[model samples]
Target: MQNRITEQPSNYRDLEKKTIEELTKLINTEDKSVAPAVEKVLPRINALIEVIVAKITNGGRLFYVGAGSSGRLSVLDVIELPTTYGVAPDLFQVILAGGVDRLVEAREEMEDDKNEAWEKLEANGISKKDIVVGISASGTTPFVLAALARCRKENIDTGCIVSNPDSPIAAQAVYPVEVITGPEFITGSTRMKCATAHKMIFDMISTTTMVRLGRIIDNQMVNVKLINHKITDRATKMLMRLGNINDYDTAKELLFQNGSVQNALKSLNPDNYPA
Candidate 1:
């Protein structure tokens, strides 16, 4: 069997050396290349964001599916959405090959199974109104490809972020973003450049989608939830600055009364609302 992952590596010539400085320099240069590779796929990422924003604006949720490191990344992105954008927990979802347990620990023979991924997605009641984005580095991960294929069959909108060109996972997705990072410093260690590129792509996708959905105002994170002490303090300051209310106590009282700065501002004045 051909190892699709081991077959690609553009930096093997440099890893053969024993010098520490050589390895450090080679890794730094390779890491620097990740952003440019991601930049090449901006147009594609933007399109996916547009679709995601439209769906979310229409009361639809977004889901991320992947396996191994890719799966973990998806989980991270979903977990952060609630705290960052004040979106409901269900607004963003994630699935892994071995389930949530695989997040902290690895599972054996999990990614190899094609049927398990769709089963998990189906259990969550994925439908046409929702958006699914599969993340894979090799672009041939059975788990990721299977999830995308099932989504296609169900007439659901699907997209993929992969690190290989003409990848099966990409071809299966309606909006495929291929970031060709070439290879790893340690040969097949995709957790290096591949993971970084995947994160870059997801950051662009999620942030842009949030912006389009009006979670952001100007460059500010206007939708963040003030659910904790730190967030409450930050939200109070932001409201004070935005509403021209310099009194800290008044700002804190307003935020506590309304539970959200946007709502508080809107309730304070009908015409001066951010909406």
Candidate 2:
């Protein structure tokens, strides 16, 4: 029951009275603190990522459980992994409060329903092989907390990203990441700075995990799915560069034949591909 820093008053007051420039400047100033707060928790984030990579490597999935803005952001992150890294659609999933189908409705009240998250997770056949990470700016959301609690009872590993210290959600997590982004520009409106930090952390976790799983080669998304003209063109160019082919048409042909830059490169030099 300690004070939640995210719920504290904003550092800048009288927002309604401030000029447009003044408001933007003040908000930007507060925004500068979010990165350092995340930086302070790098070690904790790394620990969670390590576990995620190991579990996922051994036929496990990563589930992000959250509500409100956190849940929406997680959805955005999970949906991109497949096209970005050529991973399976189900490899990374989300268990959003109110359900992802109703995400556009912004059903904030559903966050208080503690039973829903566990039911959804159970329906997904959650087991010890999967890792679930909770996302809640307050670190006290009933929906996320309950799911993690059930996960613990079932011996499924859990992790969390919260903006408060010593929160109940963190206590339930085996690998807790407390970023402590502090009060928002608008008092208790965690959708601002807290959401920003969560987005950054999501980028870190997914990008790093994909890299560790050998989805990248020399900083290129070699495993990226060529599902569009733009991406196909990009992958074709990447193949030309990596395969040392001077002709774009030839590389494009190779890319289409193999279906991916990684595969095209493998066809060119099988020894270059990772084991």
**Candidate 1 lDDT trough over 10 residues, lowest sum:** 1-10
lDDT of 2 by residue, 44-160 (tens): 999999999999999999999998797799999999999999989999999998889988998889899989999988899999999999999899999999999999999999999
Where does model 1 exceed 4 Å of error? 1-6, 13-17
- Cα lDDT computed for each candidate against the true fold: 0.81, 0.93
Candidate 1: deviation at residue 126, Å?
A: 1.0
Query: Whose lDDT is greatest here?
Result: 2
Tell me the lDDT of candidate 1: 0.81
Per-prediction backbone clash count: 0, 0
Q: Kindly report which residue stretches of model 2 are placed more than 4 angstroms away from their true locations once superposed.
A: none
Per-residue lDDT of candidate 1, residues 1-275 (tens digit) = 12354247555584555598877877898899889988898899888888888888888888888876767777887788888987789887888778876577766358888998788778888889998888877788898888898899899999988877778888888988888787687777878888888887777777888877777766766678887899888889888887789899999998888878777777778686666
Candidate 2 RMSD to the real structure: 0.9
